[model samples]
Target: MARMPHTRAAAHPRYEALLAEWNELLRRCQSTAAAQEDAPDPAPYGRELLDRWGEPQRRYHTLDHLSEVLTRTTELAAYAHDPDTVALAAWFHDAVYRPDRSENEQRSADLARRALAEAGVDADRTSEVVRLVLLTVIHDPAPGDADGEVLCDADLAVLAGDPASYAAYAAAVRDEYAFVPDADFRSGRAAVLRQLLDLPHLFRTPYGQDHWERTARRNLTTELELLEA
Candidate 1:
């Protein structure tokens, strides 16, 4: 069995229920989004593709990613200018992840918009969430909106997590892009690690910085050295 991290929230009844509800909602959201999509839905559809990929499955983009994003989103939500929208965006952030596809961001955004529309969330608010979701695809070092910043920080929070979680994340990412030749993956991974190194801090939120900044640096230094090797 994989060694899971110890989290206070993991065993809490409220959190367990939240996880169950979230999974159910995600299933419905994906279906509704596909039905309402402007472009023809992809053959496998995002949900099916995710299911087929299997759990953990040596893939970075999976339920684990979504769960972590949500966990961190909640942690950072209180600091967000628009917590609700940030939370919504987090739920839809990786809805359309495909290792080989470049348009995953747009597809993910569409999915968020469709579900938000069906849920009768405010039109303007949904638009903002969609915009934030799109931002993750082509990340900007500086996020413009509070919700965007909050979501952005939450997505990258893994880099700043504890050493154990950070190590697992690194391994998960390598497994995710396992199909790529090792040399190519190393080069690309190095560039990403370098970018994080250039950042003043990996996380945007003050709380995140305080909690994860130092650890993230430690992880980055180790990762960069390995990549260079």
Candidate 2:
């Protein structure tokens, strides 16, 4: 595939590190895929994926979010069934994001299928990647699904960040929904928060439960209060 022009600068100081990690993950995925079939190199696709994540209209679902998820996936790697697949899912889960649309996850999954197929990834691995991407939609994987649990937890790890960071995340989300009226946004956001709060468990993995459950709950409750006020 042809590479797109790279235009996004590192948003965070650690962005370079994140980029390195992303490249490594893509390399692993492509290597495994290539082992079974004649696959194109993943470097071009990696550049294109980064470019998509850097699109200006994306406020919350930008490269920063991808970096965070990738970081968390690394931290929680031990719990994954196939860490490479989980990492790939993190890269593509929001690759085709649009805050105004409901088909983001489905579209992203479809993109994953096409890209993985073109890269000559075998049916099984590509299907796993697609399944993992779709799991991000409802974030409710069946019990004992280790990779699914790990990916879901990693994607939501931001909710467990410190107060300042959590506030920034909430604000960024609001900015993404800038087109919506305040009342409508508040109502919709509150509903989402409530659903999360009502969940029996937010982070499914043991690591997430041990480290992030409490903080995530606190952050969500605080945000819900602010939204209500």
Candidate 3:
């Protein structure tokens, strides 16, 4: 499989740019009532999520990762039923990430549920956003889940990165789990790679299936071999 260039997620954005992206997405998709005099400002929520992404504990799940998925999602927006809605889910998917925690996705989904409702996102869209955030826990979205397919495919696109980019991704994941011993990390990492390899398909969108699948599998297999070796 021929490798592709890295995702723009690797490109770091200025804090202001990301904040503006969030604010714009929120306002564009916000419920009609969100514009009322009593409505809470959405900017603050965007800033808070950015702050969490910038936290000292994060390595791989940083703002760079967020931008990459957002960019990829935008590129695949043609496949989504509601692009901005799925975009919002990408913002909150790792908003509450903590490397040692197993419940980060749940926590992130809860955060989206509370923040979006308070910020005046419509109930139905908010629910869908929450559902998408949780979907990352299992990168499989059922058939015809257009929005889910876009989000999941964008999130996992890092797997199809060129060798240097994939190496960086692997190194960053190891850095995130720096607390774990070498042998333990090797076993755990190998298990994760194996699980991904076991999946019938690494991507769901037609574009993803055609473009990312082979490269992603090759990258994952190479990394798995290194860990087991």
Residue 34 CA displacement from its true place in model 1, Å: 20
Model 1 TM-score, all chains together: 0.74
lDDT of 1: 0.67
> How many clashes does each candidate structure show, in the order listed?
0, 0, 1
Residue-wise lDDT of candidate 1 within 49-97, one digit each (tens)? 2342233333666556666777788888777877767766776777666
Residue ranges of candidate 1 with Cα displaced over 4 Å: 1-58, 138-144
**TM-score rank, highest first?**
3, 2, 1
lDDT of 3 by residue, 1-229 (tens): 1123223322345677998888888888778777774567667877787777777788899988988999999999999999999999999999888889999999999999998898888899999999999999989899999999999999999999999999999999999999999999999999889888998999999999999999999999999988887
Cα lDDT for residue 1, candidate 1? 11
| lDDT scores of the candidates, listed in order | 0.67, 0.86, 0.89
Name the candidate, 1 or 3, with the larger TM-score value. 3
Assess every candidate by TM-score: 0.74, 0.91, 0.93
**Model 3 stretches with alpha carbons more than 4 Å out:** 1-13
Report clash pairs, candidate 2: none
Q: Which is the leading candidate under lDDT?
A: 3
* lDDT measured at residue 218 in model 1 versus the true structure, 0 to 100: 88
Candidates 2 and 3: which is better by TM-score?
3
